[model samples]
Target chain A: MKLFSLEYGLFLLSVFYIFYLLPHRHQWKLLLAASLGFYMITVPLYVVVPFTICMVSYVAGLLIENTGRNEWKKAIFIMSLMVNIGILIFFKYVDFLTKSFFMALGALQSHFFQGSAFIAAPSPFNILVPLGISYITFQGIGYTIEIYRGNHRAEKNMGLFFTYLMFFPKIYSGPIERAHHFLPQLHERKTLDYELVSDGLKLIVWGLFKKLIIAERLSKVIDIVFQNPDHYAGIPLIFASVIFLVQLYADFSGYTDIAIGSANVLGFKLTANFNFPLIARSTTELWRRWHISLSTWFFEYVYNPIAIAKREWNQWAVIYASLVTFLILGLWHGASWKFVVFGLLQGVVLSAEFLTKKFRKIISSKLPEVVNNCIGVMFTVLFFSFSLLFFKAGNFSDAAMMARHYFIFTGDESRIYSLFQAFKLSGVLKLTFLAGLLLAVEYLDRNFDLKKVISRQAVVLRWLIYYMVIFAILTFGKFQQEQFIYFKF
Target chain B: MTDADVLKQVNEIFIDVLDNESIVLKRETVAKDVEEWDSLTHIQLIVTVEKHFKIKFTAAEILKFRDVGHFCDEIIRKLGAS
Candidate 1:
């Protein structure tokens, strides 16, 4: 079931009521059932596959934890990793592999592949994507790693462990909650607090506004321009590129808000997945702010390990580590070559920043603070937008054509204006207002909670602002249900 | 190799590596405390510490050190508990 749908809302309400009303000792069972119910609602048949895998992994983790022999522990850990990754690769990469293999055979002109005889043979089975498989797979892997590393004690209770992995609120797009933060909460007795509920509702409302009013609206234009880049070149493409930045932020951050807010209502605080990424003046700063959870996850688990593997390699090793991590990150998004290029572009930009640090320090000292800040922000936005072409394009050729048009600036400006007009000025104005609203809210909430700030205002002012926000969302919000952008990952 | 001496040396290295002259190190000081003490420059700190202390730390030990105090203690202990 969709997280924001009415049916899902009713399901959540029922789960919440029963969750608290159940005996404290039996709460884990309730959560486990709710999680199974949640997954079953989406993928009824394939639901058992992940559940069974998780159960086996849970048992294996307990075996590893209880085993006295170091060799036995290592064996168990490897087995767990192999199983998790095997499932992930089979589902995510089999098609890519099969396609590549046939293409290779075609290039070689293999006799077996003649007339599409062997190569075009249908697969024995159709692969069905389990809902939220990537998320739960990562969670399971992290749990096994933590157990192997002795960072966390394995949960003896199978129900609690299963519930921890399949928490419905975070099963799709996630903050990628770590064992340290999430597992402890599963064991705690949750007490309902009015403030928590109010804050959570506010967050959920804000998330809906971001998704419905801002992201979905912007997506309409972005999808249009990106789908037919040749038809709308230059300024139109540029505008769409900029809108993409907004769309990405709103879509992913909106999902995170819903996830965190839902969990918060149950007294489990999921990690904050974003900061004010748009305010970042540099690529590095942008990484720090955007997708904070995934970035930190990669840093801790992937980058740090590669970096520390060879101390003698020093700064070069660090740079290479960053590059490799980002490359892996890009691959993690999808098996597409476009994602590979996108990841490499980001890695190149970040690596350049590192390599030029000394030169920048010498030159930057002469520039005024305002000039530097402006230059930094411009460079960041321009580079970010350029890289996103890969993300937006249908293929490498499409991305190249868009890039060419972007730099040539040879498209008809009048045509761009007409195209904008075709979209309706009212839609454009609504989008602009939504963007402005997000910026204003982010500006105010840069340091502290905007809702809390509003709550503390004069009663009349507070009510006015609240009503205005609600009215704007209800009136201007895009009502078409669009899947979150990150759900594809 | 006293705690004070280690702190002083680490502080100087932090200032030099980060190019922030007014850096002050405390027990709880972390990489985030310095502007330029990013992942790249972090290796510079470790290398500099190794040279100064005449010791080496395993990757696992390095990863486990939470803050400057732990790092300093580990370095000191690695250098034959001087």
Candidate 2:
């Protein structure tokens, strides 16, 4: 079920109450049952593959841990890595690979016959891609590697380890929990506190407001503009791109908030994935903040190993490593060539920054630091907006068309004027009116503990604010679109 | 050699590799404690240490060092083994 849907909301509410009623030691069992139930309900037979992966990795972790021979341990590690990564590739990339193979064959076949004589179209294979397969598989691989590295001990309990992999809150789109961080916490028998419940509820409310009001509404217009950018020009393209950047932020971060909030109520703490990424002053810094868990996964698993292997190459090593890491990061988002190009662009930009830090430092020293930061923020936002055009577009050609329209401004004066006329400051204001309210609360909540601040206010004032927000949500909310934006990934 | 001697040599290598001469590493110091020491510059630091100390670490050993003290411990162990 979509996390924001009414059905899932009822599920979470009932699950939360049922969880605390259980004896402390049995709490984990309740969670495991809930997790399995959630998976079964949402994905049906798709659950078997992940269950198999979890079992394989669990056995692999134990073997690596128990084996006294170092050679065997390393062999076991590589075998486990291959199996998990192999599963990921087979499931996630099969359709892409199949289509690509058919296209290539079609090209070769078309050469023998005249242009319209031959066509090869492969039927799209419908694979039941399990929920959070990438996330759980990565977690499993990391666990195996950690065991071999002597960093973490293998979990003796199969059930607990399985629960960690199948944990339902993060199953759709994860702040991919590392084994070392999440495993020990699972053992703690939690007694629910009133404060924890309140905080969790507040965060969930805020997350819902972000998704239902801002992101869904913005997506309607974004879908129209991106779907047919050739029909529009200049300002509309720019406007759509900018709005899209914010919409993605609102959607992804809102989902993350809800995930973290739900886990918190359940007395588990998933890592924070987004930390005000839009406010980041530099692209490098933005990457560090955005999808932090995934970024760390790449840095630790992909970049560091490659860098160390090429250590003698000096900074060239850094560039090579970063290029590979970001490309994989992009590919992880989807199986399209668009994602490949998007990643290549990021790797190029980031490598450029690394190579020219000395020159950039010299350039920056001439400006005031605050002014430099402002410029950096502006540049990053524009660059990010440009890159996401590929992510948002139907394909590479659409992205190119949008980019062309954005820069060429070749439409007739009447068309241009009408496009400009279509831009309504008031329309955006109306759509984002509740959005603005949410963001203002978020801003206040940033520097200080907003809940604590609200706690100290008169009870009537606090209730008034709460009631007003809830009222607005029920009255003005777009409950129609319930799927979180990241579920596809 | 004791960890103290390794620490002295490693401290100089950190200063050179990180390009920050003011760095004074304590036993508990990790990557986050230093501003210039990030994952990108990490291998540079490791390679510099191996060159200066004339020792090598395996790929697994390379990623397992937890802090400066843990790094020094590995260096000492390697020196003794050699």
Candidate 3:
């Protein structure tokens, strides 16, 4: 069930009710059943994919922990990695691989044999990848890696291990909880805390506001422009590109908020996935703040080993590792060449930033502090927005067209007016205002815990603020229920 | 070498690799406490420490070190073992 739906709300309510009714020790049993039930209901037959991962990872963790011989442990680790990664690659990329193979063969035939009879491309099987397979695979692998590294002990309890992997709240899109962070919590005796639950409810409301009010409203316009880049250019295209970036952030972060909030209500703390990434002054800094869980995952597992192994190459090791890690990260996003280009663009920019650190520092020092900060924010935002075109486009050619058209500023002010007309004036104005308000609050929240500040306010004011938020959401929020953008990854 | 000696050496390596002479490391110091000691510079410091001590660390050992003190203790333990 979609997390935002009435059914999911009822389901969570039922689970939460039974969850606390059960004894603390038996709570895991309820969670395990709920997780499995949730997954089964969400993807029916494809539940086997995550079930298989949990089994493999569970057995591998025990095997790695029990094995004394380093070589045996290493062998088991490699095999487990291969199995998890293999499953991910097969389901995610087989179609892309098949299409590319046939295209290459067709090109070779036309060059050598004059296309004696042009080979027709076969129809795709259109395999349905399991929901949250990427998150599942990464979660399983992260757990196994921790065990293999001797950083954490393997849980002997199969039920708890399964529950850890299949936890319903985060099973869809994860902050990718680490074994060490999440496992111990299962054993704790959780007493219902009214304050924590209230906080969680507020967070859920805030998440709903972002998704429905801002993201969905903007998505209507962004989708139109992105779907037909050739239909319009200049200002409309530029406007969509800039706001599509924002829409993506709102949608994905909104989902993350709900995931984390639900977990909090259940007395489980999932890792925070975002910090206000919009204000980041550099692409490198942006990554450190954005999609923090995944970025940390890559840094910990992928970048560290590669960089350390090639440390004899000095700074070249860092550069090489950054490129390879981001490339893999790009491929991890989807089975498209456009994603590869998007990822490489990030890699190239990061590498250049690293190489020019001294020069940039000198230049920035020459400017006023406020001016320097403004310039840095603008550059990072534009760079990110440009790269996102590649990520958003249907294919490489579409992305290239959008990029080419971006620079053609038709000097037509009507283009903006037409966009406003298409979006409807009130909708566009609401989106603009909400987007700004979200950024301003995020900036302030970073310096001070705004939630805590609100909690300390008079009961009347607090409730009034909450009511206003709920009122705004109900009145202005889109009910179309767009799926979260990161769900595909 | 004693743990204190190893800590001293590690501090120097951090200063050199990060190119920040003002970096002062304590037993409780973590990566975030030092401005330049990020994941990228972290590897540089680790490699520098290995080269300076003529010792190597396994991936597991590197990953397991919780803080500067844990790191120094591991280095001293390795030195004593050798």
Candidate 4:
């Protein structure tokens, strides 16, 4: 059952009713069952792995907590970490490893056969990736680590831990809640509040509008340009790159909104994920604002540990740590060379910024503030767009071709006009309308909730705005259910 | 040194590392309290503290200090040992 679908809407309604109707003692069971039911709808058998892992970890945590010996507690925690990471590695990286191994063998064989006049082709492996595995595994690992650190107590109840791991709203894409934030909230009694319901519904509607009208429609043009980069050049590629930035923002933040909104309806608060990333004045600021949950995850778990471990090695170690963290982040997206390069480019750029911080400060002081801000935003956007070539292209060669075409501008203007002509007038209108809507909403809600503002406005004005938004979505929204962009990760 | 004196020195380190003139240190204040108290600046603070106080913290001890109060306590413990 999809989170946005009518069936799932009904399911959530029933679950919410049952949850609030039930006593505090039994409320958790309903949520656990509902979460499992939601997961079962998508991946029935694969659900067992995460469910079992959650149970085992829960037991292990309690055991560690009860143990008197520090050494035994440490051992138990290490075992839990190893098991969780072992499961994640096996399920996520098996196909990548297999293909890599075959490729390496083929390379050696080809070199040998060049002298012997023989040929052999390595067959690729087909792997069925489990749904929501990345999110659940990460949450599990974070929980284990938090317990180990004595930052949080381990949950003795297996069911509660399971619910924590497989919370339906955040299962697909996440705000990646930390244990300390989410667990206690789950244990608390929630009352049915009318304001919460209304606010949640409004946020969900806004998220749907973002996904359907803005992201999906823009994606059509982005896919067209990226699919055949050789056909178009210069301005068209630039337009595509700009559209991609919008699409990524809409898709990711939209999903996060829905996740947070749904959690709010249940009286659970997930972490805020996006923070006006496009408005960022620097690549460093962009990272700080963009996919904040994941960025912070890398910061706390990956970057800090590595950087701290090698602190005596000085600034070079800091730079190296940042690069390694970003590279791992890119690899986390997919098992592709393109993602690796894309990540490395971001690392290199950000590291350059860190190295030149003093020089940048001197230059900024010399220039006008407005001019400096413009240059900073331009540099970040251009760098981001250039790296996105690796994300959009199928392989390294395709990425190179797109980059070359983007810069060289060798293709004819007639070709660009032809490509533009291929898109429907309605698609163009929809894109323009959605872009305007997104920008207006983002501008208004730059610092606070736009919905709250609307709610407090004159009733007639608020109703008119609401109806117009709903009408636009119904009339112009792309209805095809494209999987959220981050689901693959 | 007195706790207040230690804190005054710590406050100077925070001001120097964070590049902020008006940094007010509190018992409950952690790294996230200041805008510029990020991981890189954090190491610089630690290094500066080590040089100023002639004390070193183990990784485990560093990780355990949740706030300024805990950090102060650790610093005091190190100085007392010396």
Candidate 5:
């Protein structure tokens, strides 16, 4: 279910009230039952797949824990990993792989047979992907991997492991909770604190404003340009590309805010996934701030192992690790060549940064810190925005055309005139006003901690502001259901 | 070997790998204290230390060394054990 939907709102209200009345010990059972109900609500048949995965992983964890210092535990861990990964690959990538293989074979055959074409019908056995399969699957594997590494002891209780896996707030799109950090907090007594609740409510409101008001509004403008870039020229495409970045950031991060806030309201603190990535001064810094949980996961599980394995290669090992890790990470988004290209772009940039770190440091040290930071921020955002060409494009040709035309100096000489031509005064002005307002809020929040200041404000003033915000949401919010961009991943 | 002797050797390795003769090491030094000592250099430093000391570290042990002091302690303990 969509977090912003009326159904979810009503469901949460009922759950919150019921949760409020429950004693601490029984809360896990309620959550597990509610999680089952939530999955059943999304897709009834697919519940079997995720439930089976959780139960299998739970058994694997138990088997690993009991067979200490035995070879069977290693075999069991490998078996569990294979089952989880095999399911993901079969469901997500099999078709992509099959099509790709045929396309390659067709290309080779074309050279031998003059009139031959590579054409094959797609497979008929269509499988419906479960909503939170990747997330839960990763958590399940991470649990067993931790057990194998001796970093974590397996959870003895079956229900608790299921509760940990199916924590519904983070189920669909995740902060990808670790078993060690998250499992301990599940059993703690959670009496509602009014301050925490208010903070949670504020975060939810802010997240909604970003999604409904900013991202949705921006999506309309971006769709016009991206859907048919042939109709548009340089500045319009450029504007759309920049706006798409904002829209995506707002969309994904907005979802995260609501997830974290909802968890916070229930006295469960999920880890943050984003941290003002747009303002980051370098690609490395940007990655550290953007989708932090996923990046950390790859760093821990993928990159570190590869680098450690190839430690003798010095800098080459790091380069190899960065490329492989990011390539896999990109493929994780979806089964598409475009996503591969997107991942490659990031990998190449990171690899280059590793090679040129000292040189860049010397150059950066020459400039004043503030000036250096500004230039760094500009380059980082521009580089990222440019690479997203593959991510937003229809196919390689359109993306190539966009990139080919990105440097065109002839089309619409004045950038200002082009923007005016592309957007209506009201549309442009409204976007500018809202964007400026958002920047103000972000600035205050980042620099001075806006939440703390808000807490200190007079009660009447606070209520007035709250009412005004509610009125604004009613007046200007987008009412249509727009799925979050990360849901497919 | 003494802490000072290991520190001197580490300083030499840092200088050799980073190609900067002016580099020095301190007990308090962390990754951020040296611009050249990123993740790539980090593993190289560890592997070099392992080769130099003729000892191996588990992944967890390698991860436990938060700074030069922690690293020195691990190296000393391993040397004493050997």
Candidate 6:
């Protein structure tokens, strides 16, 4: 079920009522049941996939923890990793792998015996990849690794572990909560807090405004230009590409806000996934802010180990590790070359930033502080927005086509005219105004507690502001029930 | 060497690697306390500390340091063992 839908609202309402009615000790059981019900409702038969992986990791964790011999612990660790990773590969990458294999074979056959149909193209394996398999398996793998590393003890309670993996709020698209951080919270007794619930409700409304009013409306404009890249060029293509990045940020961060807000209402805290990534002054800072959980996951698990092992290579070690880590991170997004390119662009930019750190600092020192900040923000936004062309495109070639068409502007009124013709001028202005309002709110929110400020105001004034927000959402919010973009990952 | 001496030496390494002589590290200081000490610079710090102290750290050990105090404690323990 869609998190933004009425059905989910009803479901959450039922759970909220029953949840507080139960004793704190039994709260976990209700959460587990709710998670299982959510999974079954959403993906039906594929519920077994996460269950099987969770079972493997759970058993593997116990075995590794119990084993005294280092060799035995290592064996169990590798075996469990293989089982978890193997299942993920089969489910997520089978089609991509099969297609690549068939293409290679076709090329080989043509080279050997002249061009022909070459035994007919194999039908695509239209596999039903289980929802949240990437996230679920990664969490499981992270848990097992932590246990094996002795960083954390294996949870004896199977139910709690399962609940951690399948927790309804974050399972769909994750803040990929680590076992060490999350398991301890599950053990705590939580009482209802008015502040927590109030904050959560505010967050939910804010998330809805971002997703419906900003992201959904922006996606409509992006779709026209991106879906038919051949029909448009110049300013329109650039506008669509830049807006696609904003749309993605709104949609994904909106989903995260709702996920975190819902979990908070239940007295469970998930990690904050975004930190105003658009304002990041550099690529390195951007990664730190954007998809924080995923980037940190890769940094901790993937990058650190590789960097440490190859430390003898000095800065080159970091460069190599970063590239490999981002490549894998990209593949984690999708089993496609386009995602790989998207990831490589980030890695390359990050490496460039790293290499030129001293030089850039020197240059910034020479420039006025305002000029430096402006240049940094402009460069970061332009580079990141353009790179997302790879992410938004249907495939690799389309992305390349868009990139090429970005610079091919016709010096005519038609180019600007086509964009206006495609999207109404008044609608564009409204979205622009809304986007500007979002930025202003975010900037203010970053510096101060917006909620607290609003609360401290006079009752009438506070209610007026609240009603205005509610009215804006009610009037402008698109109730199209558009799926969050990150859900596909 | 005393823990104070170890902290002093580690402070020098941080200043040298990060290119900021004005950096001040306390026992409770964490990576977030220092603007330059990100994940990338973190490896550089580790490498520099290892080289300066002539000690090796396992991946887990490297990752386990919660703060500057823990880092200093590890160095002291390694020095005593050696």
Best by DockQ: 2
With candidate 1 superimposed using the best TM-score fit, by how many Å does residue A232's alpha carbon deviate from the native?
3.1
TM-score to true structure, per model: 0.93, 0.92, 0.94, 0.92, 0.92, 0.96
Label model 3 with its docking quality class. medium
Model 3 C-alpha lDDT per residue in residues A106-175, reported as the tens digit of each score = 9998899988647877887688889889998998999999898887899999999999989998998898
Task: Give per-residue CA lDDT, model 4, range A98-163, as digits (tens).
Answer: 777767777787687764434444464465667777778778877877777777898877777888
What is the alpha-carbon interface RMSD for each candidate?
1.5, 1.4, 1.5, 1.9, 2.4, 1.0
So what's the TM-score on candidate 1?
0.93
What are the per-residue Cα lDDT tens digits for candidate 1 across A369-444? Answer: 8888888887887789888898878987898788777775554742568456645677667667767878788778
lDDT of 6 by residue, A1-489 (tens): 888877887888888889889997898899999999998996689999999999999999999999999999999999999999999999989888888887888898899878775476668778888999999999999999889888899999999999999999899999899987788889888788889988887888788888988888888877988888777778877777778778888899988988988888888889899999989999899999999999998998899999988887878888988899989988888989899998998889888888888889888889998899889988998889888988989999999888888878775422888888888798678667766777888888888979899999999999898888879888988876668888888
Give the clashing residue pairs of candidate 4, or none. none
Off by over 4 Å in 6: A108-121, A410-415
In candidate 5, position B25 carries an lDDT of 83
The candidate with the higher DockQ, 2 or 5, is 2
A80 Cα displacement, candidate 1 (Å) = 1.2
Lowest lDDT sum, 10 consecutive residues, model 5 chain A, at A409-418
Instruction: Provide the overall lDDT of each model, using Cα atoms, as 2-decimal numbers.
Output: 0.80, 0.83, 0.86, 0.80, 0.81, 0.88
Best by lDDT: 6
Error of 6 at A434 (Å): 2.1
Leading candidate by TM-score: 6
**iRMS, model 3 (angstroms):** 1.5
Each candidate's chain A: what TM-score? 0.92, 0.93, 0.95, 0.93, 0.95, 0.96
lDDT of 1 by residue, B1-82 (tens): 5899989998998888777888999989887877788766787788878877788888778778789999888877887654
Q: Which scores higher on DockQ, 1 or 2?
A: 2
Off by over 4 Å in 5: A112-126, A412-418, B2-41, B51-55, B58-60, B63-70
User: Fraction of true contacts kept, per model?
Assistant: 0.55, 0.68, 0.55, 0.18, 0.45, 0.36
